[model samples]
Target: MSVAFIDSHMVEKFVENSQAFDKCIEERFNMLDMNQDGVLSRDELQNDANDSSFVELALQSKEEVDSLYDVLFEKFDTEKKGGLNRNEFGLLMKEVMLAKAHGFGETPVCVIFQEDSLLRRVV
Candidate 1:
């Protein structure tokens, strides 16, 4: 893991760069896919969530985190197919990155991004 200071401007620039953003998201999706299948199942998503310690989720209890992941998985599974395709995963990343950008505002915050994490790629 490595630490870096990230602000909204940095995140916005990364998001605006469509090619880089898409590439990073695609790589992350593939990493989380686990089974080499084109689609990501709920179990795969849950496992990824459980494996990663997200900054925002640090304060939440296990039950709360599980519930949150369920909601997030449902949001990403837009087709109601019980799995997330590459396109759906891309959309999910877009929203998540945008949300982080907005949440950061003008302040730079210290963050420890895990190796292979999307935030690390953004930086």
Candidate 2:
């Protein structure tokens, strides 16, 4: 049987326990920052065997992961910046986590490119 990708109740509980989620995100961020770079690049942040830890915790796809880099380059590149800086990086990470969390499910969440909206059945 295919495992359900996300648990809505768990997410609700996660939101209810905001502090816990914050801490979890903080720790997850640290773990994602391999090589001690303090910032995550597309290559560094992309899902891989080495970084499969997030696979079990979050439901994601290769396309979504790749698209994230594209979105980051498109939106957060204020000042025509070539890449994300520390602040931009942090915001990007937060948004990604939120989007992912919002989209968690058995099937990959369809991300609406127009407003970057997430479409899913929460209830």
Candidate 3:
């Protein structure tokens, strides 16, 4: 294949992957929203806290949800809006994925992003 054609194909693939990633994030966030309000409240996050596996991946345990809420607010709620919308959730998840890929397996959601900003930024 010609170099220009390969470049075009690569761009198309990148766009497709990005869209898929966004859709996945949206689906996950919507599931967590619980109120269909397009943002995550403390109560909504409590749902995940109640789920043992989810809490394990997110913070620590259901008992630590209060602190988990604070960490999420500080890290993901970049606008200081008191709740996280889909975009923020998606961005935060992107950082989470990077953290996982970088040998930080099951550390905790808060710790994953707070220690680094480079992984969260898209460029």
TM-score of each: 0.85, 0.45, 0.60
lDDT of 3 by residue, 31-93 (tens): 788889888876776776565334364655555667767887899998898888888887777
Candidate 1's displacement at residue 40, Å, is: 0.7
- Evaluate all candidate structures by whole-model CA lDDT and list the values in order: 0.83, 0.50, 0.58
Query: What's the best-to-worst order under lDDT?
Result: 1, 3, 2
lDDT of 2 by residue, 59-109 (tens): 657677567667767887564545445556556645655565666654443
lDDT of 1 by residue, 31-100 (tens): 8898989898878876776656565566788888879767877778888888899999888888988898
Task: Report clash pairs, candidate 3.
Answer: none
* Candidate 3 wrong stretches, greater than 4 Å: 1-16, 55-64, 104-123
lDDT over C-alpha atoms for residue 70 of model 3:
85
Worst ten in a row by lDDT for model 1: 49-58
Greater lDDT among 1 and 2 belongs to 1
Q: Where in model 2 is the C-alpha error above 4 Å?
A: 1-6, 47-67, 76-123
The candidate that wins on TM-score is: 1
